[model samples]
Target: MQPRLNFYKASQEAYNAVKNLENYVQGCGLEPRHIHLIKLRASIINHCAYCIDMHVKESRHDGLSEQWINLMSAWEESPIYDDKERALLTWVDAVTRVADTHVPDSAYETLKAHFTEEDMVKITVAIGVINIWNRLCVGFRAMHPIDQPAKAA
Candidate 1:
C-alpha cells in the first residue's frame, strides 16, 4: 500500500511530543522483552501492518526468538509464554481494545500479579504509545519497507 503522507514532516513539534513519550517508555524500567511483546501485540490488534512489520524486525534485533514473535498472533492458544509474559499480553489486549473492553479490572489484576504498580503504569503508557502509532500509521496508510522480497521464514 502507499503512504498518505509523511507524518514526521507534517509537523515536527507534534512528532517530537509523541517521540518524547516513546523515549520515556524506553527508559521506564519495563523489561525490553515485555515492551517488545506489548508493541507487537498492540500492532496486531490494530491491524497496522506497518507497525507490525517494523516491530517484528525490532523485536528480533532485541533478541526475541522468531518462534515467540510468530506466536504472538495466536497468544491465547500458544503455550510458549510464561505467566508474567501472559499477564502483560492480556493487559495489552485489554488496553488496545479499551473502547470495547473498558480496560477490564480482571486484566489489571492479572498484570498486578506479576508487576509492581510502577511497572503497570509504565506498561499502560507503553501500550498507549503503540496505539497512537497504530492510529497514525493506519490512518495514513503508512507502508512498510521493501528492502527484501517477502517469503516464509
Candidate 2:
C-alpha cells in the first residue's frame, strides 16, 4: 500500500515527539523484550503493518524467543510470559484497544501489584507512545523498509 504522506519530513516536531518516546523506552528499567512486546501489541491493535514488521523483527534481534513472540497475540493463555510480563501485556492491549475495552480498574490493580506507581506511569507513557506511533504510521501509511528481514542472525 502507498503511503499518504511522509510524516518524518512533513512534520519534524511530530517525528521528534515520537523519537523521544523511543528514548524514554530505552531509559526505562523495562527489558528490551518487554518494550518490543508492547510496541508489537500496539501495532497489532492499530493494524499498523509497518510497526508490526519492524517491532517483531527487533524483538527477535533482542533475543526474544520466537515462541514468546508468537504467543503474544494470545498472551492470556500463554505460559511463556511471566507475571510482570503478563500484567504489562494486558495493560498494552487494554491501552491500545481503549475504545473497545477501556482499561478497567482490575487492569490497574493488577499492574500496580507488579509495578510501583512511578513505573506504572512510565509503562502508560510507553504504551501511549506506541499508540501514537501506530496512529501516525497507519494514518500516513509509513512503510517498513523493503530490505528489512523478519529475523536477523
Candidate 3:
C-alpha cells in the first residue's frame, strides 16, 4: 500500500524531533540487539509491516539469528531467551500495550532486576520511540519495500 502521507515532508520539524529521539536511543547504552528486539517486538504487536521489515534487517545485521528474531514473537513459549531478554521483552510488552497493561509493577520490577535505573529509562524511551513510529507508519499505511526474488546462480 502507498503511504497516506509523507510524514517527513509533511512536517520536517516533527519528523526531525522523532529522529533525534531515535539517535539518542541508538547511543543510550543499551545493546544494539536489545534495541532491535524492542523495535521488532513492538512493531509486531502494532502490526506495522514497515517497521517489522526494517528492524528484522537491522537485527540480522547485528548478528541476531533468524531463529532468535522469529522466536521473539513467541518468546514466552520459547526456551531460547535468557533472563535479561525475558525481562526486556516483558517490559516491551508492558510499555507497548500500556493501555491494556497499565505498565504493571511486576514487569517494571522484572526490568529493574536486569537493568540500572538509567538503562530502564532508556529502554522505556526506546519503546516509546518505536511505538511512535509504529503509529505513524500504521496510520499512514507506510508500505515496506518488496524484495526481489533470488536469482538462479
Candidate 4:
C-alpha cells in the first residue's frame, strides 16, 4: 500500500526529537532484547506493521532466536520467556492497551517485582515512546519493506 505522507520529511525537527528519545532508550540499562521485545509487543497491540517489521528485524540482528520472536503474540502461554521478560510483556500489554486496561495495579505490582523503580520509569517511557511511534506510523500508513528475499539474478 502507498504511504499517506512522509512524516520524517514533513517535520525533521519533530522527528529528531523522537530520535533523541530512542537514543536515550537505547542506553537506559534495559537489555537490547528486552527493548526490542517491548517494542514488538506494543507494536503488535497497536497493529503497527511498520514497527513490527522493524523490531523483528532488530530482534534478529541482536541474536534473539526465531522461536523467541515467533512466540511474542502468545507470550502468556509460551515457556520461552523468563520471569523478567514475562513481567515486561505484561506491562507492555497493560500500557499499550491503557484505554482498555487502565494499567491495572496488578500489572504494576508484577512489574515491580522484576524492575526497580527507576527501571520501571524507564520502561514506561519506552512504552510510551513506542505507542506514539505506532500512532504516527499507522495513522500515516507507513509501509514496511516487503519480506521477500533478494533474487539471485
Among all candidates shown, the one with the greatest lDDT: 3
Q: Write the residue-wise lDDT of candidate 1 on 1-153 in tens digits.
A: 678999999988888999999999999888899989999999999999999999999999988999999999999899999999999999999999988999888999999999999889889999999999999999989898767767898
Q: Tens digit of lDDT per residue, candidate 4, span 1-153?
A: 789999999999988999899889989898788899889999999999999999999999989999999899999999999999999999999999998999999999999998899999999999989998999899999999888898899
Q: Kindly give the stretch of ten consecutive residues in candidate 2 with the minimal lDDT sum.
A: 144-153
Which model is ahead, 3 or 4, in terms of TM-score?
3
In candidate 4 the C-alpha lDDT for residue 55 amounts to 94
Candidate ranking (TM-score, best to worst): 3, 1, 4, 2
Model 2 lDDT, full chain set = 0.85
lDDT of 3 by residue, 1-153 (tens): 668998888999999999999999998788988999899999999999999999999999889999999987899999889999999999999999999999999999999999999999999999999999999999988889999999999
Backbone clashes per model, in order?
0, 0, 0, 0
lDDT (Cα atoms) of all candidates against the true structure: 0.93, 0.85, 0.94, 0.93
Clashing pairs in 4: none
Error of 1 at 66 (Å): 1.0
